[model samples]
Target: MKMIGLVAIVASLINVSIPFQSRAETVLSARDLFDACTRADMDWISFCNGFIQASNDHAVRLGMACTPAGTTRTHLVEIFEYSAARLLVSQSELGDAAGLEVASAIIGAAFPCN
Candidate 1:
């Protein structure tokens, strides 16, 4: 039957795709984050913002960073972009670093508590 053939095709397709999905990297790298942040696409920009905000939140909770009361999300993004660029350029190995680690370092350095 055509329906049975179609079902078999669909099942085979799903099986083929599973390995690729599993191989996808779950952790975002600093280079990838920097690329996303620098993109002109709104979707990428939004992704960058969300990722930075989440990283900032975690860093704050862990006492790794101390954001000033007047600091805005845009400010945080700027800080990350600038710092990440310099860091990635100076330390090429850091491009492979976890996004969270890079973001936390940037945030902490930008807003260190005395």
Candidate 2:
């Protein structure tokens, strides 16, 4: 009887935790955000592997020069240029102007093109 009670308790705990995992979602495409921004702000290479995967997927999607090198600083500069151009055009669309400026500064730190 004790064993059965313990088993039931464990089962209930598992059931309760299952939904929590499913309800959580990735907030942003780490690579897209990094490419559009910077590594320093993102803890430097924390998202490298994931960013590479996303970039490869994007490369396949857009047929652009996005190689497996997307996670590297060199590749990131190219991505930054593209992202900056897009962001410049869509400045009015950004809801948080200050946040965008900060992000731009962080990205610039990695590649001081400006």
User: lDDT of all the models against the reference?
Assistant: 0.71, 0.38
lDDT by residue for model 2 (12-82), tens: 33344434335335333223454434545554454544444454444345443324433565565454445
Angstrom error of the Cα, residue 41, model 2: value is 6.2
| lDDT per residue (tens digit) for residues 1-114 in model 1 | 132332333233334432433533876777888999999999998998898999888778878678888888888999888777776766665666567666766776666655
The list of candidate 1 runs beyond 4 A from truth reads 1-24
Query: In model 1, what lDDT does residue 36 have?
Result: 93
Please report the candidate that would top lDDT against the real structure. 1
TM-score of 1: 0.76
- Listed in order, each prediction's TM-score against the native is 0.76, 0.31
The model with the greatest TM-score is 1
- List runs of model 2 lying over 4 Å from the truth: 1-25, 29-37, 61-73, 85-89, 92-114
